[model samples]
Structures are given as structure tokens and as C-alpha cells.
Target: MTNPTVAELIARSNRLGADPANTNYAGGNTSAKGTETDPVTGEPVELLWVKGSGGDLGTLKPEGLAALRLDRLRALVDVYPGVEREDEMVAAFDYCLHGKGGAAPSIDTAMHGLVDAAHVDHLHPDSGIAIATAADGEELTGKIFGDKVVWVPWRRPGFQLGLDIAAIKRAHPAAIGCILGGHGITAWGDTSDEAEQNSLWIITTAQAYIDEHGTAAPFGAVRPGFEVLPEAERHAKAAALAATIRGLASTDKPMVGHYTDSAAVLEFLASEKAPALAELGTSCPDHFLRTKVKPMLLDLPADASVEASIARLIQLHEQYRADYAAYYQRHADDASPAMRGADPLIVLVPGVGMFSYGANKQTARVAGEFYVNAINVMRGAEALSSYRPIPESEKFRIEYWALEEAKLQRIPKAKTHQGRIAFVTGAASGIGKATAARLAAEGACVVIADLDLEKAQAAAAELGNTDVAIGVAANVADADGVQAAIDATLLAFGGIDLVVNNAGLSLSKPLLETTEKDWDLQHDVMAKGSFLVSRAAAKPLIEQGMGGDIIYISSKNSVFAGPNNIAYSATKADQAHQVRLLAVELGAHGVRVNGINPDGVVRGSGIFAGGWGAQRAATYGIKEEDLGQFYANRTILGREVVPSNVADAVYVLTGPELSRTTGLHVPVDSGVAAAFLR
Candidate 1:
């Protein structure tokens, strides 16, 4: 028997969606444009056509199919700002569609553009959606596909989404395709038939799972019971909840707006659910990854004061952070530092649903969706049996799995100066000297900016590579000197890659005894110097395209108010805030700004030798040597974290390895703060 042709398979796939109810208009579309471009020929090529937008696969037509230039589409994989330049991108689509004139490209044009396969097919399979919509979908997915399929959790579809898909394709070149959780499935093949078959296989597999597990009764039927409050009372209750959530979230994004007059949601909230509605995540884990596992739950009696209720909520959040830290440590092995790090999970309100938080928008959205899904699954599972989530230990393992850790690990290692020039303030000794050495080791051409020209040059000579290291003497607090230093850096190495705002003086004086002169002097060297240097380097870093990294070496005292070091601590705190604001502003441009709060990086210069250390040690009733040991012993790790430890952290953030991380204040104080308080 002759094999079915591409036309036959396309027809078969279309026929399978013939039922009008199954193929809702505008709900599903198919396209036959093989919109991939050949890298070598630079000519139009056709492999397999796809269904155009708004055309149901059930009745797709040849005219509905846009025959595309495969090579041209492939070329788009490497495009930048992806679809942020929609006009140009859409115009390219127009050219791809028309040759001279073709049918408009599918709405999933970017999706098709990213795939390298000759034939591609996409569908919002109902069964697939049903399965994806479940809370434990990931577990169910594992049970169903085992290791056969790759699952991409829900992500907003567009340019970035396409980039993510392209990355996945590159990583799993052999994957038949992928299932986008909470969205749909994508199947690609050497031939159109195989792609369609894979799509069918995924849908049928999901259908089989649904048949075995049974469908959830409509929410209205299984909905838990709750008191129907008066409209005025409901409004008051919701307002209180919203205020609590906003206070915890530090955002006013109308989280509680969705719950106003929402009795069904309110019922879910006020129910006697085991996990408590606030503790349950959103519809999916993706949401949890962003909003966290819970939101602030305000369960005070109606007569309770709002201020008091808020205080209780803050206390709850503290407890949540503590619990999460304990949970992380309980399951994490000794091997991974990442496992030991603290990340905000979910914030929960007693009578409200959870809200997740993450480092960025994409992560936040994923967390929200995941939370919603998790809630739905847990509620549904309750009907079948007890809704037992995976053991906390298991959740911890999954959360901190080596594979996930690997994703965090994949950050680009700081490249050897890859067009990045760095200016290290106070580069002669202590943490500044170590930072300069670390940056040089990572390939950044270094400019040792210091007050002492001789010592700076000596430090540069010690680095040994004259080609990569240059020494310059300048008072960082002087605006003109900073400008000159920046100019010199540009002349030596085309552009600046990083700046170590590590120059500062630590004065030990009680707040009452700190003279105005002393305060101003401390600020001049630390805060003013940082501002001057950063202002000078900003333009060049922005122009470099590859975002720049700035590391402000702050102090643990910034977070914890330490006696007799008020001047030094206040400036460090301001520096940390400066980095935070910088991160928020510079993030859009790819530049990352963060701080390293090191406790006691012993080894030469700065506060340690300036008599300040001895004074601080005396005040604390300990000798200088004992002060270092005291801090080390006060940490969870019980290791004396050296200047190199702090330097390594700076390198991690500014280097390639932590490209996605920014606006973070990493404590390199051997977890001293964690030991002392939170």
C-alpha cells in the first residue's frame, strides 16, 4: 500500500476536527505554511504548508494554507527584540506569505518561525487543555507520558515565548514536540502526517487520563458552602483583604478586585479546607513560582481593627518565611549552595487565596497560573479522596531538583572582559583588592581607581597581565576625577563592563558622638563616590548592548542596625537601596545592578586597620581576633567567609553565570543575618 501523502494527512487531521462543537470558531486555527528559511541559499523554499489564522482544521482549505519560505522563517529564529518590532516582523511575515502575495500568516507565526522542523502543527486540544488546567498536571503528565514528552509550563505567547521554544528545541533536539501547560500542544515532524499523528497521540493520551480519573463536577455543584454576607459587609471584608494583600505584596495590582462580590470565590475562601484556601496556590504551580504559595490571609473577626489585623498578617509572613527556610534546609543536601539559598515562595491569607512572587514578570505570571491550577486540582482531588499534596520533602526535592538547579547554574560564567571594562574603586587592598583580582580573573579588563597612585600601580603589577589591567589614581569622591577615570577606561578597553563600588571608610562612633564632619566624610567616600563613578560609566554601559553589572560591596550592618557604626551602616544601606532602584530602572536595558553585603572579609586595609575595628571589637567586649570568630560562629555555615568569598559572589552576579539575576542583595556574611534574625 502506498503511504498517505501530505495532502491526505492534512485532510485527515482537518476531518478529525469536523464536529463544530469540538472545533469552536476562533478557538482553534490551523496553517500549512512551512515558514522556515534555509540559512545557506537565502531563497524561498516550501516544505509543508500550515492552516492560516481563524480557519478551523476541520475545514481547512488549500487557499487557507499559506505556503511559506522555510528558509525565511528559519532566519527569524535569530531575530532580536523578537516581535517587539511587530511592524517590521509582521511585514516580514507579509513578504513570507505573499512571495509577491500569499495568505496572511498564522497568528502563531512567531511560534512557527522558531521551529526548525520541515513540517509543524499546533492545536489547542480540548483534552490537553483539560489536563493542563488541573492542579497536579505536572504529576499527571509524568504518569502519562513518563519521559516521552517535554512539558513547558504556561508562558505568555509572543516573541519571548518563541525564544523560549527555540531554546527548548535546541536543548531537546529529539523531542517530538512539547506540551505547553495551561495552553496547548505543539507537534513537529519530518513530514506533516507525523506531526498530526503526534498531536492526536497527545490529545488521546490526555483523553485517556480524563476517562480514568473522571471529569470534575462543575464548580457550582461541588462548591463548598459559605455565609452569604450583605453587600455592604462583603465590600468591607474585601477591602480589608485587599489592604492586607497589598501590604504584603508591596503592590497595588488589584488582587482583591477579582474577589469583590465573588461569593463562589468567597465560599472557597471561608471554607474549612484542610490546607486553608490562602495556603493553596493559584490554578497552577506556574503562578506559585511568581506570586508565591500563598497570599496574606486576613481572618480577624469583623470587629477587629484593621491595623491589628495587618500586624497579624505581617507576623504570619514572618512565620511563612521561617517555615519555608526550614523546609528548604530539611530537604537540601550538603552539596549545593543554591539549595541553601532562601527564595520567597507563596504568601497566604487565612480567608484568601495565595499570591506568588518571583524575580521577574515572566516568573511571576508562571507562579500565578501554577497556583490557580494547584488549587483546582486540590479541590477536585478532595472529591475523589483526601487531597494530599506530595510530601513536603518531595515538594522540596522537586523544587530544588538538580535539573532545576542546573537551569540556575546555566548562567553565563563571567566572560574574560568580553567587551567589558571595569573600574574598581579603592583597588589597593581588602575587599576592593580582592574584587579587582576576581574581575581580572574573569576576563574583565580592570582599571584600578585609587587615591594612592603607587599602591594602585603595584596592585595592577601584582595582577601580572598588563594587557588586561591598568592602574589609575583618582579620588572617587571627586566628580571630575571620576569622569577622567571613566574616560581613561574607555580609551584602554572600548567600553566598561562592570564597576565595583567598593571604596569606603568605616568609622566606629555612636550616633550621638558621630560629628557632622565625620558623617559627611563617610558619605563622601562611600555614597558620593559610588554616585560619581556610576554616573560616569552609565552611558558607556548602556551603549554596549550586553548589559553591564555593578556590584556595591555593602555591609551586614546595613540590614541590622549596629551600635557605634551608624555612619558607616547608614551609607551602606543607602548604597543597597541605590542598587535596588538602579536595577529596577536599568533592567529594561539588560543591565543588572546588585549589592554584596559582606560581614567581615578580613585581610588588610579599610575598617580593619583604621582603629575602627579595634574600637568596635572593644565595644562588643571581644578582642579583634575574637570578633571575626564571633561572627563566623554566629552563622549557620560556621565558616569564616573571607574577602575571596565575597569576591566570588560579586563575580557571580557581574559575570555571565548570573545573567538573569539582578536587584539582589546577596549576603556573603556566612549567613550571619540569617543566624541573628531572619
Candidate 2:
């Protein structure tokens, strides 16, 4: 018979409720066929269109499929777990996906590309209830389909799953597709019809089996309990638990375990089956990597001692660590030191569901999902037979395999600007402009703050459609103006990442000859201005949770104290100290505060003006033309200090490359200050 039509198959899939419902806000996606441009050649190629972020599969239209370039996607899959190189991959894919040759790639593009079928279809089918719910799924699977199907245990989808599929293709070249135990299924074919048929067959077969044997009644129930504690007592208990978890993990932010009233959970705890339930972990082995083999079940009277409850939790956690260590040791290779270390990614609370932990939020979420799904599956599976995951040996190999570990290694832990943001003050001019430009070039959303409103706007315009730069005007000494600048920055980009306090005024004056008005004028813009801007920027930086960097632009005069420069010297000294105080106060928030002291910067309007440069040259007894050489020769490297040099110092503190060193005074004076000391 002729292959079923794509429309007909999709309609049938919808009728069977296999496709995600468009009206169901959280339902999944669908796709179509089209073409996109090639990034390298700017040529159009055939593409299998996919839904955009918000499109629902049930009501999906032809427009929903994004027309992604299959060839480009295939290339990306070959480089599995290549998130670190996502920028390059995305750029290429966008060119191929949209025919734009420079658009952004979709987040799911990688997964869609690697499926290796003409019309690949995927969804979290409710038939997940069948495979996941079956406690004796392995035997049940055998009884159901025998050798016609392959059973691959559950692994977190995305890079790891993709990589595993690639490996399976290499090993069992004829295997059509595999069941992702406790998760979902993948069906593919040369045509959309074939793919949908495969999917329908899988779902219907599973449904038939579940309909025949699945239990309808709740397996267990939890009894009610009461807690009569004062508000203060409850607050104290939560705070103490939060603190304890944080301390144990050496992290400031830990998952705060929640108190739940699930009857299923309470009944499970009160039942004689609790110990047996603890012995068998989540339904599938994949969950072992998440919630561990067991949860910490708390069993105590409502009025039981608080200390006793806490002590039990602590003891369970310690036991988890010990068990995890033992598992690692047991499976670890004797010859390899690196192979002998691993830890539990999750903790199970007996009466509570599960508490997943990770170095960051995304990882924690993944762990939590795995645990919840696994528990539900195990409970269902218990009805058929005892719930048993893959052998520990197999789990150890899957978890510790250098290839699988390599997959984890491939995922970028953090994007380039993971923790920091940058603001470049006085960004319209020579040093300031270059500094702002450099910060943007290094992944910072550089906010160009300057008194020269037009110049700042011009500088931003020059950056040319770069998402990493914004221009704002502010007289740094005006508290409201500074605050407004910061507010605008937050509105534009969520939060402030870094502050390049480069906006300042300079004046040359003799010590006794300087008037109070002149001293105040110089200090107001240089020292006081930097202080005000930093103060305004601090609140949002702290709220960002990733500490921040504040770089004060002090001059070399602060260190190489010179004749007739009393006002400049005093102000620079105060600004440098301000950075020190900022470092101390904001360190807890993870902010790194520092100062860059530059001298003899060539090509600038403020201090390097015609008369000022000539006068400074005369003071050193050098000709105006020879000033550049004079300053250049003063440094050990014989390099002239420029705006780019100062910008480099700012970049170092804000970039992902530096993680530890902070609260420093970096001299970008071409060694001029050191020369004076010598």
C-alpha cells in the first residue's frame, strides 16, 4: 500500500492523543518541511521545519516548523556535547535554518538535527505511564515484544543521550530505535508516515499491555499528622535547615527541603514496607545518578524532639556520602586515580519526596525531574514484580565511562560572561571609548556612561548593532543622575556586571598655589564622582548574586606624587582607597573591586590637551614632540601607555578568564610609577 499521507498520519496521531494539544499550554511541539540558507556558502538547502518556542504540536501549522537545515544539524550532532562551541555552531545553523546566514539557532536545534531520520517524531507520551510504571519492566518488555525491540536504560536526554544513541548506532547498526526506560520513546523513518506509524505502534502496544495489567487503586496511603509550633519555631527550623545544607555543601545557596502533606508519602513512611521501599531506589538506574539509591525518610512523632529530627537527617546525609564513596571505590579502576571519585547527585527524604542537589540551578532541576519520574515508575512497576534497576556494575560503567564523562565535560559549565556585567564610564572618548569597546568585545554588555552625551551616543552608534553595548549620560557626581544611570542599565540588561569608573576630570595645580575652589572642582569630578557612581551601582550588583567588579580609574599621580600636582594627587589617593573599601564591603556578594592607575596616556582631550601636554613636557624639561618618547622610555618595556592599555586592565578583571584574584591595584603606566620608585 502507498505510504500514509503526512497530514493523514498527523490527524490520526492527534485523534489518538499522541500529539501535544495546542490548547494545553504545556504541551510539546511539531514540525514541517522547508529550506534554509547555508552559512558558509549563502546557498539555500532543504530543511525539516520545526515549531518555535511557544507553538503546540496538537494545533501546529506548517509555519511552526522552523525549516532547519538538516545538513548543518548533522554537522552539529557529530560534535555532540559541544555547548562550549555553541556560538560557532549556532551561527552556522542559523544561516542554514533561516536563510538569514546570521540569525540565532534554536535551543532544540541540536536534538532535532541528530535523530538521523527523514521525519523524526518525539514526545513525552502518556504511555510513559506504561513503561515507567512497570516495576518488572525488563521481563515485561521481554514478554511483550521479545527480541523485536531494544531496551536502553534511562539517561538524561540532550548531549549524553545523543552521544549514547550515536554509540549504539555504531555497535548495533541494525537496531531501529530503543525504548528510553522510565522516560520516553523515539520513532523514526524515511518518511513522516513511517515515523508516525512507528510511534503509533509503540504507544498502542504499550497501552494495550498497561490496560491489561496496570493497577487502578492507590498502592498505599499516608496518615495525618499535626505540628503545633509557634511561628518563631517554624522560622527557626527552616533557617537552621537551610544553613546546615549550605554548610554541608560549602555553598551559600542550597536547596531548601520543603515539608509536604502527600498521603502517599506519609502512608509509605508509616507502613512496614518503608525499609523495603528504601532498599529499592527509583524505578530506573538513571535515577540513581539523581536521587541516589534511597531517600532519607523521617519517622517521628509530631512532638518528637527537634534535635532528634535534625540529627537523623544529618546521619542519613552522612550515610549517603559514605555509600556514594563506597560505590565509587567499588567500581573505580585500580590503576586510575581519577576514576575513583564520584558523589550522590541527589538526596531522598523518607516522608518527603526527594531533594536534588547540584552545583547550579539547571543541574538541580534535572536531578529533581529524574527522581520524581523514577519514583512514580517504581511504584507502578512494583505491581508487576519487584522494582529493580540495572545492575550497579552497569550503572558504574555508564556513569564513569570516560566517553560518558567526556560528554559531561563537553557541556559548557558556564557561558563566557557567566557571572559578570560591565559599565564603561566616560565611554565616548579615547581611553573610555576604547575601554567600553574592549569590554563589549569580551562578552560584556558595556554601558557607556559619559558626561559627553552626544559623544557617548556616537560611540554607541559606532559599536553598530552589537547587543553588548548601551550608552547613557550621567554627571557622575549627581547622585540622582548616577542612580538613574544605574536604573536605566538594570532596565536595559537585568543587572550591572561591572563598573569602569573611567569618567573623571583632571587639573594641574601647585600645592600652596591651589585654591579651595580649584581643589573641590578637581575632587568633585574625579574622587567624589567615582564614589557616587560606585555607591549607586552597588545595590543591583549585590542583588545579581554573582558578585561584581568596580574599577576606579586613578592616575599615576596617586603613586608617583609630583611637584605642582597636590590636588590631583590627593584626589587620586582617595579614589584608590575607595576601591579598597568597596572590595571589603562587597566581597561577600562576590564582587571584586580594584583600581587601574594609568600615566602618560597619549591622545586624550582632558589631561593631554595642547597647552597641558606642552606644560607637562616643559615641567619634565622635554620638548612637546619628544614627550611621547620620554614617557615611552621611562617604562621597562619601552611601551607607551594608551587608552587600549587601560581598557586591557578593565577587561582582565571582568572577563571569564579570571576567577580568583581580586581587590588589586594594577598599574597601566608602562612601568613609569616603578621607575619613580627606582
Tell me the tens digit of each residue's lDDT in model 2 across 1-678: 312333543453354333321112223333334444566788877665544443445654444445565666676656644633343454455555544322133444554556555555554454543464355565666676555445666653445455565565446555455566655555555666666666667667765666677665323444344333344453334333332332333223222122222444434444445556666565343455445545545555434454676677667657766776787788778632364323344443333233455443334444555555554455545545555555566566546644445445655655455323467787888788888778666545667888877777788878754244668898987888887677666544435667888876655657677899979987888888898888877765664455667888887877776767788789988988898898889888888888888877767645566366776777788788777778889787788888888888777766657767676788887777442422
What would the C-alpha RMSD of candidate 2 be, to one decimal place? 13.0
How would you encode candidate 1's per-residue C-alpha lDDT over 657-678 as one tens digit per residue?
A: 7888998888887777542424
Q: Please give the lDDT score at residue 34 for candidate 1.
A: 37
Show the lowest summed lDDT stretch of 10 residues, model 1: 251-260
How many steric clashes does model 2 contain? 21
Off by more than 4 A, model 2: 1-415, 464-466, 604-606, 621-625, 656-658, 673-678
Top candidate when judged by lDDT against the true structure: 1
Q: Which stretches in model 1 have alpha-carbon errors above 4 Å?
A: 1-418, 674-678
